[model samples]
Target chain A: MANDLVVAPMLVVLASIVAMLALRPRPRAQRVASVAGSLAYAVAVGAVAWLIVLSPDAPGAATYQLGGWAAPFGITFVVDALSAFMLTIAAVVGLAAVVFSVVFVDRANQGVFYHLLFHCLLLGVTGAFLTGDLFNLFVWFEVMLMASYVLVAFYGGPQHTAAGFRYLVLNVVGSVLLLLAVGGLYATTGTLNMADMSRRLADPAAYGIDPAPVVGLGALAFATFSLKAGLVPFQFWVPGAYRSAPLPVAATLAGVTKKVGMYAIVRVYFTVFAGATVGISVPGAAGASPLAFLAPALLVMGSASILVGGLGAIACDTLDEMLAYSSIGQVGFIAVPVAIAAAAPPGSLRRLGLVAALVYALHHALAKSLLFFATAAIRSATGTHRLSDLGGLASRAPVLAGCFFVGSLSLVGIPPLTGFFGKFLVFEAAARQFTASSGLAGGAVIAVVLVGAVLTILYTTRAWTRSFWGRRTPAVEGATVRRSQVAVLVGLAALIVCLGIGFDPVFEFATAAAEAALDREGYVELVGPAGGDGA
Target chain B: MKTTARIVVPIILVLAISLLLQGHNLPGGGFIAGVLTTVAFALIYVAQGLDYLDSGVLGQEVESGAGVFEHRSVTAFRQTFMVGLAVAVASGFAALLFDEPFLTQTFVIVEHLPLYHELEFASALAFDVGVYMVVVGVLLTILSVVGAE
Candidate 1:
């Protein structure tokens, strides 16, 4: 049953790849196959989520041994609440993207294996989420990156090529750093299995290893993940990459790919190195955990990202460019909760932070995909994504305008939308931390997040009003909007609204995922030996 | 180039087959074997040209065959690649039907064989063969598609 949880998605991926390869020369067949494949993948992911939810065990994590080999030696796939949740989100977004691409992508681009690469990208992401070992996570990351490299450069234009090249180079550098960190960790812990590594790291001194180097390696791993997630000081490539990518591909990358990075950070920080301590030594003081020292830095960076991204979005002229910048800010919002989650002890506060992060991630995936899909339709209808060249789209394509308006409102965290609940949760968590800690850092995080939220509204409103309102421009006069594309946007918008209205169940789901994520002992027990060896 | 191809292609093919066959027990495996086979074909293409591959040394009838190989190397490789992927996935699914985890391998031993006393057959070998075909097909597809341009 556990093996089926992992293999189901993989089988969909493999079957999709085969279908694409077989039907490559036939565009119509390829489109149908890709859509069907994506739908099947979504169903498989849904089943996996259902299985995880129905598990009798507390925390709900199931570990599947590949080829019947046990963990700490052979590959294993772990489907916990968090992983299942992420998988479901990814599959849903992937399905929407693929379906949109059937008519959204031009014929020439479709011929160049678009469907094949899309499925490969999903495979990589799902594999990353489910993998139980660090090395396999890296492998999955590479698979994801490889597909993205081509997708970013799908148009074969000069700007697209340059943007793709920068994306490639930066990601490759991040990969190398990750590999170095993984090597150092394996050397110190003598294991690549995450649970085994966690157990070993819990008492490094017993293994004759120094804790400082291990802590440093963990920081390196965090830095690499931050780079992948497009955090501040490492986000130079994102705007270009997002701006130049084919619109649907950009939607998938922003909606799904960057969250994989965030997932890795959560997995590594909370699970693999959950026990490391990292504060200054005081003769009579209790030792502080590494996450305590790391949290402030992450908070500062997260705050900086919000400021930079929000300001950049306000300053950008093009619609896609603004959305790209908005992505950075939204990611920063997600990061705020991540920092709090990492810093807080295993309690309600920490769980709140984790839940906030998960909710924010879910909101961002849907809202951003919706926004980008709307951009695709707008671009198709207007023949440009430039804001100045487009106006009065509401009159020409009222459905698209309405979808974009709803998406923008959700993105800005307006009331009664999914994004508002996400932002509200983060604020509540930050306030809780501030009250408990009464520290300057916690207060600052709360302040910065508040400001970031305000700025989000300002920028999203500006982009919305500038593009969709006022007198019609020449560019919008004779543009044709495809019904299928509009349907995708409306569907996502409807989901956003539905989830917003039914926030209690969704929030509870996210809380459960957070609980599973923070259950270090439960994870170790499931993936490692019980009351033996390292235990 | 022709002299080099004449001397190297046959040896490469033989080496690839040996590697593929022994992969189940030895360090040599389907991936390397497939790569080696692709290298041989690439060498032939570089030395003897696409025309040679289509209708020359391998013969027109061989190229025009209904199964597997085709006159157009790209199309043939594409088909081969898809088939290989399907086969690989199907092999994994085979275990699921038997109430086992995916990609599970089971061995069957035959006793009192004609030439040898016994032989062991493993489903993993079939999976490996699928992988081998995929590797060769992908590499050739890239080579032929890029080479044609």
Candidate 2:
């Protein structure tokens, strides 16, 4: 059972996917596998949740070594609170998307469609969570990208294909940059273990070494990560891909893909480059330390994303597209705390950012997935996805309308729900001010994020008004809330409430992870320093 | 493109680059190899049909698909990811021989053999193998998609 705890999730996804391989595909097997794979993955998520709940206070993280070799070498699978939290998020979101994919697949022969790409996607998610080294993380990320490329283009319409191309192309460019960063680090530092790299960065003081090289490396890595995370300037890829992808895929893309980027950012920057920003020079941003230079830059970018993403969502027609832009803004919210943390050694602003990020991530993940799934249900019933054509949906399909309202309200940051708390955390964090300069700037950015939340409410209410609040209209056959569909959405709604109501426990978990993340000692402490090598 | 040459371009590029990246202890290493592989995979579609030329030269059907091939037409590509993983694992194992950590390429006889150390070549080869598989897999994946269309 103990070993099964770790191995079961992978097996469930693999087995479900592989089983679909033999099932004659076309309409029957493909949908079955898509839904089944998702259900099984949900169960697998439960397995991990059990692990976290059962061992809440354990001192060390759970680990499994692939092929049984030790570190400084072998690929290690580490499952701490941090990894587990991210895993749960990915699994839940992924499962929801796969479930939606069952119905979204085009009518063409989809031979083993769910089997191959879905399995790869799940494996990549699993791999990303489990890997303890930098190279394996990059590899797993590509695995995710490869699967996503095929899946995004699965519909094969010209528009879908074009979106897929754009998504794939930008991500590829980012991957190249990421690859360069990782390889550069490995080449210079001589180690692939992330924990090892952090140790090297922190130990420069002990060796009395100049901090310039590592600082530069940290900057390059962070910039690549920012591109991945879509932190301003590099955020052009999000709207198209999110708007164009099939619904389930869009949900996961919004939730899982964005988080993957942020997760890498946190893993590398906080764990590896934590305070290297203490002394660097960049124009405009006053830095308490050189490393602090990135703070002003991140703040500017984060604030811009918050404003741009919020306003951008208002112009889009489809609910999913609107949410896509909102996602960009949410990313700004997530970055707020980290940027402040970078400017100051440690402060409440960073802590608040951590909470806001956690809640926002959890909030957006569940809410966006439900929204996307609800869109599919609505379209199938009404044969359209535009909000203009969506009035009177509540009267036609009351349950779905209710679900959609809940999702939208949460997204809008309605008080007492998860979104509000996430925003509250960000606001609190921003107000705390790390460095005097950072404090002033962060306070201003917090105000920007605050306004962005109001925009979020306005847009979401607009959607609710358009879709469910007007006169009753004829409903399409597949649009009514089917028991199966509602079951999943309801499950998500439950999770949404649970996270909001139970913020303290989850917040502690995220904060602890954030705190440990900021501790660079774990980076190299995990990998013992090599003698004059990959250090 | 025909299946035969679909397998060769990557094999060749990987071998050449494997030789080039062997100098990383001083400049470029695994990083360059990964880049070369990424490009090789992207370029694979144009060159895969060259397998026909290989078939003519060998007077064989040119079967390779990582699966058994009845038509012997390079079998839609046999890029051998297993070979790459094997090489990576093998290099990892060799590190054990020097009492070093896994993947930790111990530079034995570092002062002496300048032109080519077997392990350095071996390490670079391991990485190239990953490149080779990546190219073949991507090519095959695209081919499968195009063929289906």
Q: Could you estimate the TM-score for every candidate?
A: 0.94, 0.77
lDDT of 1 by residue, A364-482 (tens): 99999999999999888778988898888888999999999899889878879999999999999899999988988778888899899889989988887888888888998878988
Whose DockQ is greatest here?
Answer: 1
Name the lDDT of candidate 2: 0.66
> Model 2: per-residue lDDT, tens digit, A1-535?
3433554465566555445543533457666776677677777766665654335554434554454456657666566556667777888887777665654544453553544576678778777766778888889889988988887777678988898999888878877877887887777656677766556556666434455565556666677677767778788888777766667777787787777777776676666666443455556756434336667677788888889888988888987788788888888887776676666656655555565666677777788788888877777668787877677777778888888888887887776668777777777667666235454665577678779888888788888888787875554323555566677777787778777777777777676666556555653554444444432
Q: Residue A276: error of model 1 in Å?
A: 3.4
Report the C-alpha lDDT of model 1 over B1-149, residue by residue, as the tens digit.
89999999999999999888778888878899999999999899889886677577445544323443345655777777788888888888898889887788888889999998998787888888888999999999878766766
After aligning candidate 2 to the native by TM-score, how far in Å is the CA of B10 from where it should be? 18
Q: Give stretches of model 2 more than 4 Å off.
A: A1-57, A103-112, A205-210, A275-279, A284-291, A347-349, A434-440, A473-481, A522-535, B1-149
